[model samples]
Target: MATKSDEDRASSYEPSSAGSDESHIPDVQNDCCNPLEETKYIVSESMLMELFNVCRRCQRLATPTVHQRVGTMVKIAAECEFCGFTWLWCSQPHVGSIPAGNIGLSASILFTGALPSKFLRVLRCIGVATLTQRTFSNHQASLLFPVVARVWDRQQRDYVTRAEDRGKPLVIGGDGRADSPGHCAKFGSYSTIDLEEGTVIDIQLVQVMISFQRTILCCTTMVL
Candidate 1:
């Protein structure tokens, strides 16, 4: 009878030992072999449309100007009603302008040449692309655009080559007067391929033109 009792205790103790080992094993595995988890975010079309609407409203309120300096060459100036937020638009089909009312979109648009690379790097570091669906407050949008644009233009050359290779054509089209000075310009255009693909992926060209205003400021400041 004592032998039986001893056997039971030994068997029970054996499981405890195995359980302890199993617990410790997972910790060890986590230290060396744990797999990475991918984080993801969903972006809905409605959200994109809302962003577009806000941009349009803001542009109307801002009242920008457009004019041609030479034959077929034009420039646009966009300014904000609530702030000193200003940007320039140009008639270059290979480069588009940034949008108003937020930083990420404006930066992404103005700094198009550097966007693909820097944006991907930022997304990876954050472990996700959750920014796609995020809506920016008017103030946040105004502040964020210029900062991102500065960073983007700083490394513009490095990324331009890749952007060109990707067959992304920069096109801007708008309905504002071609030879008048105004604050807000209503326009829209998309890449030739993206438009051909039947994708509703048109970007705002007036915004791009507005964002370009920064280039003029930089040049003026340099001359001063």
Candidate 2:
């Protein structure tokens, strides 16, 4: 015999149309971009909409204007002729953006991979047709910096606060290096180290010429 609780659950759990959709939900909640399937990816839709400027409600072409362009990544603004609804689109999706499109990574993964800067130019010049100068610059400023900052901040918080490291001596170390072979290069770097963990705590580029001691001092100041 069915229990009272079973009957209550049976009445409460009436299947709705959304229940069918539950099966269609992706295993991962946030899928960045699906390059294999164009219709399923939001970025592809946006790209197509930018190209066509279609009004979804009326099924007519809407007037599109250039809102912004980062590299070849042009963002278009458009409005529905009948409904007056407005929308925006980008020429290239974040996943479809350069480096990733050519090399296959979001901006976050590019710098972490530590692929040399020359590699990008080499790729573009040698007829790796997808890579471009603007894509490199755009990824550096827009995607790479912000992602790296967040990751660095998170690492500092997580590693420093670990129970093993706390109450022990703060064993810090650092090193500096020139961007190019020359000692008089415009770009150089200083990195703070967590000696206890054998990991780099932070890395910052020294934009101007400074004494060796001053550069070391900057790294020390950051970890402390």
Candidate 3:
């Protein structure tokens, strides 16, 4: 079982202002609310390569040509060794699971002009703590959605500019607004990417409304 410390208890994990208006939605609580400690589970690069060699030898011998079979069997016998209880397998999927680099959460907080440390701290706490839930409450979901939207928007702009530079017809889809405006009184947008030109050309925003009376006030722009 995980242990909680004084720091954990003292921490005030505030949800991001991006979704503050959605506060009428229920709060997301975790059974283990503390920040998780890092665990060392990955094998070193050199060791992983060595394990690959063993797998290759086993696979090579498992082939059934007579002349190569003897050589293959000998090689397999020599390399069929296990270093520890952990089994070695192809590293592609495993490597994909490991984060290549940090998201620079601390740097973002330091550079943001108006946001205070307390607020950033709260966001960081909530972001890291709720990572395992897979799904989030409406409020929690909205908190992180804008960040993703901004990134997507930037990438789309870059791709479109590149395509225009290449003198391509920037085909685009018409925007659609939902009939019912949600608590945010905003719409959801969708776009299709022109993979050949690496551009997002078709774009649409559809409005949606939530009838729930508990809906919170929607602000034009989020203030940190």
Candidate 4:
């Protein structure tokens, strides 16, 4: 059910000159990039095509250019045949070089410690479009990991500094967990915690040896 306001909002897709030298066309709807007022809408393809098929300026059918789609983000450029005007519309906003959707999805997967391959498989199985594993890995290395690491280091420093500021000996506890029983385990994790403050201080992942063979396996295993 499309309302008059929604129909009117379609006109906001302003076109730039096809001959313009602008490498990027900014989305007017989300130009500010304000996090607090962020909003997301799941729009149907049919509805989107309905709005894009006609050139808002000339009120005539426009020829759409080759759609540039990156995972969940899509950019549509349409040129009005009559007026020779061109406009680019993006499905999601951009944060620097990466699309907001890509960043959000990648960050969510990393923060939650979810397995990217399995989680993305779930999305793909259910018809949800998302970034590929390679893209996720790239984002993790180039963007997500650095930020997360910096924040983690800062937090760890703060926790330790606060404990030291107390001018007393701190009680700490340490524990280790293995992925499997006996020598079959391929990985192990050790964690240190402040017993008095009930806060985790550090976590380290260690590779386990199996049957006198050095097998380097990278994975998180849950004993459930």
Top model number, TM-score: 4
Scored by CA lDDT, what does every candidate get? Answer: 0.34, 0.52, 0.32, 0.65
Clashes of each: 23, 0, 6, 0
Ranking by lDDT: 4, 2, 1, 3
Pick out the ten consecutive residues of candidate 3 with the lowest summed lDDT: 67-76
C-alpha TM-score for every candidate: 0.17, 0.41, 0.25, 0.67
Cand. 1 Cα-lDDT: 0.34
Across 62-109, the per-residue lDDT of candidate 1 in tens digits comes to 545553321122345656666556665543221112111122333453
Q: Estimate the Cα RMSD of every predicted model relative to the unseen true structure.
A: 30.9, 16.2, 20.4, 13.3
* Candidate 1 stretches greater than 4 Å from native: 1-142, 161-186, 192-224
Residues 1-224 of candidate 3: C-alpha lDDT, one tens digit per residue:
11246325323334443432211322323244221232324343344344334334344312111111110011112233433222322211111111111112222333463344464456446432211122233322432344445555556556545765777454432233334544454655544445455444545444444422111121101100
Which of the two, 1 or 4, has more TM-score? Answer: 4
Inter-residue clash pairs, candidate 3? 173-202, 178-207, 180-209, 181-209, 182-208, 182-209
lDDT of 2 by residue, 174-196 (tens): 77776665566766777777786
- Alpha-carbon lDDT of model 2: 0.52
Best by lDDT: 4
